[model samples]
Target: MSIKVFLKRVLIITMIILIIISALYIFQDKQRFTKKTGTINFSTKTEEKNILVNKNGEWENFFVKGVNLGASKPGYFPNEYGVTKEDYLRWFNLIAEMNANTIRVYTILKPEFYEALYEFNKDRENPLYIIHGMWVNDNSIEETMNAYDDRIIKNMKRDITSLIDVVHGNAYIPQNSTHASGKYKYDISQYVLGFILGIEWEGYFVYGTDLFNEEITSYDGEYLKLEEGTPFEAFLAQVGDYAVEYESEKYEEQRIIAFANWPPTDPLIQPYEPEDYNDIAQIDVDKIKGTEKFETGMFASYHIYPNYPNFLNMEPEYTEFIDDEGKNNSYRAYLKKINNHHEIPVIVTEFGVPSSRGIAHFDSTRGFDQGNLSENEQAEIIPELYEDIVKENMAGAIVFSWQDEWFKTSWNTNDLIDTERTAYWLDEQTNEQFYGLLSFDTGEEHVKSYPDGNFSEWENSKAIINDDEAKLYMDSDESYIYFKLNIKDLDLENDSVYIPIDVTPNSGAYKSSLFGLEFDRGVDFIIEIKGKENSRVYIHDYYDYLRYRAKSLPSIQKFTEERTKDMDNFNYIYQYLMENVDIYIKETKQKLIKDEQIFESGKLIYGNGNPNSDEYNSLADFFIVGDEIEIRIPWQLLNFYDPSKQKVAGDYCVEGLNPKPIRISKIYSGINVKRGEELVYSSNLQSYSWKEWNTPSYHERLKPAYYSVQKMFEDE
Candidate 1:
C-alpha cells in the first residue's frame, strides 16, 4: 500500500481504540457514583428495644465515628460566604472514607450545605447523616444563667423554628443568608440523624438564676422547675421541651436530641465546684419532666478532653483507675460515672486533642495544657478514645473538629494585643487552632513550627532550593515565619547565614550593601547569623545610609581577591571586617537562651520575655540539630500585619519606620555565606530577586487524610 494509505489506516485504528477506552471510562465513572449500601425508610424517627433508630431504618449501636463540621475557618466564614459545593463534596466524601457515618454541625449553615448534601445523597442507598445543632444566644445567658430570660428564650425558640423550617424544605430565609437564593430546594430531614441543642453552657452562671426553682409548664402538659435538676439542667430541659414541639410539629419524624455540655456541666468533677454541688451531675438530664414521657428520647452530650479540669486531681476515688500508659485514666472513670447515672444513651459529642506547641498549663502528671497533642499523637489518641467510649457504652464519639480553625482563641491568647495576634496568624500556643483532622491556614502557614534543627518535620513544606549540597525551606503559621537551612559540612567558626529582607512589596527601589551588594533600594531588614553562637537581626536603616560606600572611607581594594573566594578565610575576612565596619549595627537586644528540652522533645515553647523590653524578639529562637539550623522569627517583631485581619491591601498593615519597631508591609528575603566581614558567598550574587506568592506563611507537618477522604466520596 502507499505511504498515505498506511498512515490513514493507522489513524482509523487509533480512533477505534479511543472510542472503546472512552466507553470504558464512562462505565467506571457511573459505577463509582452508584451506591452499594442497603436503603431503608428514615422518614420518621423510631425506637425499638431502647436503641435509637435512624430515619433510614438503621439502628445506631454504640459505634458512632463522626467529626464536627464548622463553617468558619481562620480567616474565612462559611456562613457569610457560604460553603462552596466543591468544599462540601470534598469534605463529605472524606468523612465517609474515614469510616465515619455522621457529622455534627454547631449551628444552621448556609443553603449551599443543604443543597450539596442533598445532591451528594441523591439516589444513594446510604447517605451521610447529620446531627444538626441549634445555636443558642450564649451572650444573653452568659451573664445571667437564667434560662427563663425572656429575650434569650424567645430568640432561641425562633431560631429553632426557623432551622426546622429550612430543614423541612420550607421557605425559611435568613436575613443575612449567602448564596441562598436558588431554584433547587431540599427537605434534608431524612438525612438529619439528630439535633444538638446548644453549646457547652456555663453552669456557674446558673448559680443564682431562676433556672433552679422557677416552675414552668411545658406545652405537653408537663410541669418543670429548677427543683427537677440544677439550674443549668433545668434550662436545658425547658429548651429541649420547646425543641420537641418545634421539630415534631414541622415533621412527623422524631430525632435524637442532646444539650451540649463541657466539664463545667460535668457530673464527674468540676475544678470550680461550689459549696452546694460537688460535681456537675447535680444538674441531671433525667430529672426533666418530659424526658422519659416522650416517645423519642433525649441523651446527654459532653465535649470531653482528657487533660482538662485536672481530671487526675479529682478525689482519689475518681482517679484510682489507670490506663496502659500508666497515667491516671480519670477520663474513663468520669465517663463511666456519668453513663451509670443516665439511663438513656449518652454521647461524647466532642473529644480530641490539638497539635499545638504552646502549653497553657502543665499538670505534673498529665504534661501540658488540655488538648495539646502532636499530629501523630492526635491521630493515635482518636482510636484509643473511641475504644474507651465504646467500652463505656456511650452512643458515639465525634472528634472535636475536622480541620484547624484559626478564628478560635484560647483563654491565654485572648489577652494578646499585638497586631500579629489580631486573628490573622495561627497561635501555636493557642491549642484551639490545631485540633482539626485537616489543617487549615491560620494567618501563618500552620499553628506552631519548631526550629529544633531537625528537617524531618519539614518534608511537606515548600522549599526554596533543594540541591544535594544544601537545602533552603520556608514555612509559617499565624504567628511566625520560619526558615531552615541544611548544609553538609557547614563551617561554624567563620561561615554565616545572611538574610536580606525587602519589607515593602515591589516598590522597585534598590539599595546596595557591602554584604549584600544587592540591586534593590527596598531592602528594609537584614538578619545575619554565625553558627548557633551569635546573630544580629536589625532594620536595614540601622546602617547610616548616607555613609554607604563613601569615597572618604579608606579603600580596601587589596582584599578584593579574598572576598571573591567561596571558602571562608577567617583571618583575612576578620581584617576586612576591622577596616570597613563603620556602619552603625544595632544588634538585637534580645537574648538567645538555648532550650535543650524543647528541641529534644520537638515542642514549641514561647519564652517569657520582659513585657516592657524595648527589643522585640524578631529572630525569636533557633537551634542546630545535626547539619541543619532552624530559625523562627515572630511576625510582630518583623512588623507584619496579621493576615487573618486583613480584608484588603493597606488594612492594618506595617508601615516601615526609620529605626526601632520597624514596620514591614511586605518583604523579600535571601541567605548569604560570609567569613567575618568578607562575603564568602552570597545568594544575591546568584540571583538578587524576591517574589511573592499566594499561600499561608506557616507550615504544618500534617497533611489532610487524602485517602480516607477520597474513599468517602466513593459509592461504596
Candidate 2:
C-alpha cells in the first residue's frame, strides 16, 4: 500500500477507535471497585436521655424501625392556624399514638417550635430527634419567614446554648439541617451541623460553577438566568477563610444526607460522577464516610421516585447512557450507588408520586393524574418504596411534606378565586388519601396508627429475603397491583417489603365526593406473592402483575474489545460513553429579569446571532413555565475509573478505579429566565431578521427531523 494511503487509514482508525471506547464507557454500567457495599449502622447512647443523638448505638437501635408521622400524609398547619402549644402537643401525641418512633418537622419558622415540641414530648418515655426545618426558601421570603429566619438563627444558637446550659446532664446534641438556601451556605456556617444540599437543585448543576468554562451552560456562563451567578461559586470565593475549618478538618461522618434524582429528566447526569449529584449528594466523591465512624443516631437521606418515562420528552436513546429505562427507572443501580457511599443508616428524605393538581403536566396527552395517583396506586407504589428504603438497612423515609398544595394559586386565580382555588384545592385535597397513613381531621382524631408499637420494626417489615436465588417482579392493573406471594404461607405481618413499583394518576379535576380511600379511580393493590421458607422459593412481591418494573436498563454489548492493546484506539468505549452518559447536559440559567429570547411564529431562528422580524415566525429560546432539557455528552471524557496508585493505610494501592457516576441538577430549571434568554437571542438572531436562520423551515418543524437532537417539542 502507498504511504499516503496508510497514513489516511491510520487517522480514520484512530478516530473510530476513540469513538468506540467512549461508547463502551458510557453505554456499559459496570464497576471496577474492589470495595464492598458498606452500610452505616446506628444506635443511641441511651434511650432514657431527652437528647437522642449521643452518637452511639442508641440512635441505631431505636431508629432501626420507626415511621415519620408526617411522611405519607403530613398535617398542614397553615399560617392561619398558628402553632400554639396545644397544636404542637396534639401533633406529637397523635404521632405517638400511631406507634411511630420518629417525627420529622417540615420547614419551621424558629427554634421555638422545636423547643415547644421538645417540651411537649419531655414527659413521654419515648424520645425523638427533630429532623429540623426543611426548604429555607430564598426565592421569595415572606414576613413570617423573615421573622422565622431570625428566629431560626437565634433559636438554633439558643437551642444549642440551652442544651449546654440546663439539661439534666451533659450530652451531645444531634444537630442536622436539610437546607436549600444555596446563597446562604455562608449564612449557615454559623450552625453546628453542616447543611445537606443535592447540587442539582439549581438547574441540576453537578458541581458549583467552572470559573474557566465561558459557555452559556458552564458555571457562571451567560446561559444562567436565575440569580445571576451561582451561590456556590460565590460561596467558594469565601472558602479561603474557611480553608482552615474546611481543609484541616477531615470529611467526617456528618448527619447531612443527600440523594440523587432518579430517571432525571435532564440527560446530563450519571451515577459515577460526584458532580452528578442532581438529587442525591455525591457522598462517595465527597468522602463523607470517615475511617472514624459514627457510633449511632446517624442517618443518610435517600430520595425515592418511581419511573416516569413519559415525563421526559426525549428519545430513549438520549438517556440510553445514563439509565436504561430512559429517565423512568427506580432500579438497583441507585441502591448500589448509595450503598457504597455511606456507613450511616439511609433515610428517604423525599418520596411521593406527583398529584394531579399543581404538578406541572409534561405530556399534554398524559394528564395531571400521574401526579394524582389513586390511594390504591399510592398504597401500591409508596409502601414498596418505603420497604426498599428500609431493606437497604435505612433508618426510614420522610415523605415530601406533611401537607402541600397539589394545585395552587396562579395570576389568573384573581379572575375566579372561589372556582379556581376551590377546584384546585379540591383536586389536591382528594390526593391526601393516597399517602394517607391514617385519617387526620382537624375536628376528628386518628383511630389506628403506628406511634410506638402499632407498627412492626424493620425486621418485621421484611416480606422478601435478599439472597442468591431471588428473582421476582411487581405488576399492576389500572388500580390494583397483586403480588401472589410466590412463596406461600410466608408471614408478612411482621415482614418488611422491597416492592419496586411506581404509580401516577391521570391529570384532571375530580373529587371523590368525600375524603377517604374508598372512591372510584382510587388505586387498590394486593400482593399475590409466593415463596417457601422450606424449599425456599420466595415471592418478593405479593401481587402477581401489580409490581414495579426495572427502571434502569442493563448494559448491553455483543462483544468486548481490548483497550489495553492501544489506548488511542478506544473509539468503541468513547462512543458508548457519549451515547449513554449524561455528562453532556450543560445547565444554563437565564435570569427571568435579566436576559430574554423569543421569536414570533413567522420569525426564523439561528445561532449566528442576527435576529430580525422579516422572516422568522417562531422563537426558540424562551423559558415558559415547566421547561426541561434533554442533553447528551461523553462519559469517559469526564474521567471515570482512574486507577492511580495511592497509599491507603501505608499500603500502595490502585485506587479511583470504581464506578464514577455522572450528574444531573436536583433544583428546578427556570422558565422565565429561559424565556428571557430565548427572547434576547431571538431579538438578535438572523433567523428572526433575515428569515433564513439554521434556517428553521417548515421541514425543520418535523419531529425527528427537527434538529440533531431526537426531541419532540411539546409544551405540557
Candidate 3:
C-alpha cells in the first residue's frame, strides 16, 4: 500500500500499451507496401457473349500486352543460359516494369521457373500471370499424312494432363533429357489465366489424312467427313477439349484455352475455289463438334506475319478493301475474314518481323519474308499491328519473343554450317534468331569511323594486314559503317570480291563451314561485290556467297573433263548467282534490300534513295577511284537501329589483323564471271583481320529498338 509501489505499477502498464501500439503500426506499414492480385475470370453470358472478366466482376476488356519468353542468349532452351534464381527475379521484374502483365511459355520449364513464380507472387498484389502452353512433339510423325497419329495424340494428351498437374502442384516431374526433374514446387494455378495447346501445324502434309476413323459424321446436322474437314482441325478440338476438362476437373475454375494455328492452317491466302477450301484447316470455331467443351472460355489464336506466304498478294475470293498506305492491302482483309469466321474473341499468339540482313523470301507488293525488318523498323511497325489488334476488337496479342536466340536457324541460313561461330553470336543474316525484342549484351562501343570512299576519313581508324596483299582499314560512325581497302594490282573487273564482317565477337565457330573468306560462325554480314556495272556495291549476306549459290551452282568436285559442265551451263549459273543469289542470300536482307530493281544505281531505285536523307536507305554507295575503293554504307543498312548514339571521333588501334577474319580464303577461286571468251584469273586470294577491341556490339545498336518496344507496350 506504499505510494512508490503504485507509481511503479502505472509506469509498467503504460510501457506495455506503447509496445502494442508500435507493433500494430508496423503491421499496417507492411500491409501498405504489399501488392494486390487482380486475377482474371471468365463469364459465359451466351454462346457469343463469353468474355474475360477481372476478379472485381467488371467486364474485363484487358488487351493482353504480353511477351513470349525464350532463353535467346546462350541457347533457346530455358536452362541454357545458366539462369539462376536472381536472373528469373530480375527478368520477371523487368517484364512487369515493361507494362506487360502476362508472360507466355511454349513448354513446361524446369522447377526453378515454378519456384521463381512463387517467389515473385508470394505476397505481391499485382502479380504476373501465366498463359501456360502444352507442347506437342511434331518430330515423331512417321509420315506427313499422319498428322493425327494415335501415338502422337496420346503423347499430347499426356503432356496436357501433366502440364495441368504441374500448374496445380499435383505432379512430381522426373527430370527428363529436355526438362530438369523436380517436384511441382508451387501452386501457380490461381494465376494461370489460359492455356495454349499445340503449335503451328503444317496442314499441307496432312491435307487428306484419314488417321481417325471415329470421326464425327456431322456437327449440328451438317455433313462432315475426314477429307472434307481438316484432320488438324479435328486434332485441335480434341486437344482443346482435354485441356479445358483437365483444368476444370482439377482447379474447378474457368480458364481460357486456345489452339495454336498459323497461316498454313488458316490458308494464308483466301480459299477462292472449293479445291482451296478442302485442303486448309477449317478455323470456324462455331462449326467444331467440341465447341461445347470450350464453352467455359475459347479464344481464336493464330501466328500471322505480313510477308510470309505473301497473303497480301492473294486476291480475296469474296471481297477486299484498301488500307492506310493504299496498296490493295489485303492483310487486314484476311484478318477480318478470320475474325468473322470465329464467333469467339481472337488473339494473335505470334506476330512479328525480324531484324536481319539475310533474306529467305521476297514479295514485291507486300514486303519480304520473316517480315524482314530492322530493330528500329520493328518498333515502328509493331505498334501499328497492335493498334490494328485493338481496332479489330480482339482480346489480346503476344509478341513472338523476348530475346535473340543464337541457336536458331532460318530457312535461308540453315543449310550452311559454320565451325567458328559460337552459340552466343547473333547472326544478322538469319531472321528467325532476331525476332526477340531484347538481345545479348556485347560489351563497349567501338570508335566512330565514316566511309566516304576516302582513305583520309579512315586515317584515325584501325588498319589490318591481309594474306592476300590487301591493306584493310575499318571504322564506323553513327550514320554509316565505313571500310577502306588498298590492294596492289587489284583486278576490279574479273576477280570476285568479298568483305565478310563479324559484328558479334566471341561467338566463334561451332560448325565448320567457310563463307567467302569470313568465319561463317560469327559473321553477321558479308559483302560480296564484283566488277560488273551495278555489281560494284557490296552484296549483303548472312553466310558466304557459296551458300547463296548452292541452289544454282553445280556440285563441288575436282577438275575432271567428264564432271566439267559446258560453258553455257556454267554461264547460266554464274549469271543467276550474281544477279539473284549472292545479293539476296539471307532472310535478313528483306530489311535492307528490295526484291525489284535492288541493283539499280547509286540511288537505290526501289527503297529509300539517299543515305544522308532521313528516309530509309538500304543500298551502300561507293566511288572506285582507281586501285583504292572508298565505300560508304548507311548504318541502317548494317541493322544499327539508332543514329543518335553514334560518336564523331575515336582513337586508332594498330593491332595486326585478327586470325581467320574471313570465312573462305577468297570468293571461290575469285573468278565470279567469265564472258566474251576472256577467261579471267585470280592469282592471289586473301583473308584479313583487325582488332575487335573497340567494336560496338549488335546489342548496343539494337538497344533503342528493344527499349522502344518495351516503352511502346507500356504506354499502350
Strongest candidate by TM-score:
3
Better of 1 and 2 by lDDT: 1
- C-alpha lDDT values of all predictions: 0.54, 0.27, 0.51
lDDT of 1 by residue, 1-716 (tens): 99999999999999999999999986875453243443222332324213355444555542456789888554454445435778888888777767677788887777778888988887777677888887766567765566667766777777777666667666456463322333225778777777787776664555545345555422232322234445456566677777775555445445667777776656544432222222334455666554343556667777877665533343454467776667666677777877887776677889766766544433233443344444545555655566667678787778778877766665543433232333345555456777787775333433345554335778776667656556667765555667777766667776776666555442222444345445333554555666554564554322212112233333334324444231122110110000111121123322222211111112123322111233312123676665677777654334343433321122111222122232333345666666666765555311222233333353323233323333332322
Per-residue alpha-carbon lDDT of model 3 for 345-405, expressed as tens digits? 7777777667654455444444533534555566666766676665666667787777766
Candidate 2 ranges with C-alpha deviation above 4 Å: 1-81, 110-112, 140-200, 204-268, 271-285, 288-299, 307-333, 341-345, 354-369, 403-425, 429-716
Give residue 492's lDDT in candidate 1 (0 to 100): 71
Backbone clash count for every predicted candidate, in the order shown = 30, 180, 40
Q: Using Cα atoms with residue i matched to residue i, what is each candidate's TM-score against the true structure?
A: 0.62, 0.36, 0.64
Flag the better candidate by TM-score, 2 or 3: 3
TM-score preference between candidates 1 and 3, better one: 3
Error of 3 at 502 (Å): 17
Worst ten in a row by lDDT for model 2: 681-690
Tell me how candidate 2 scores on lDDT: 0.27
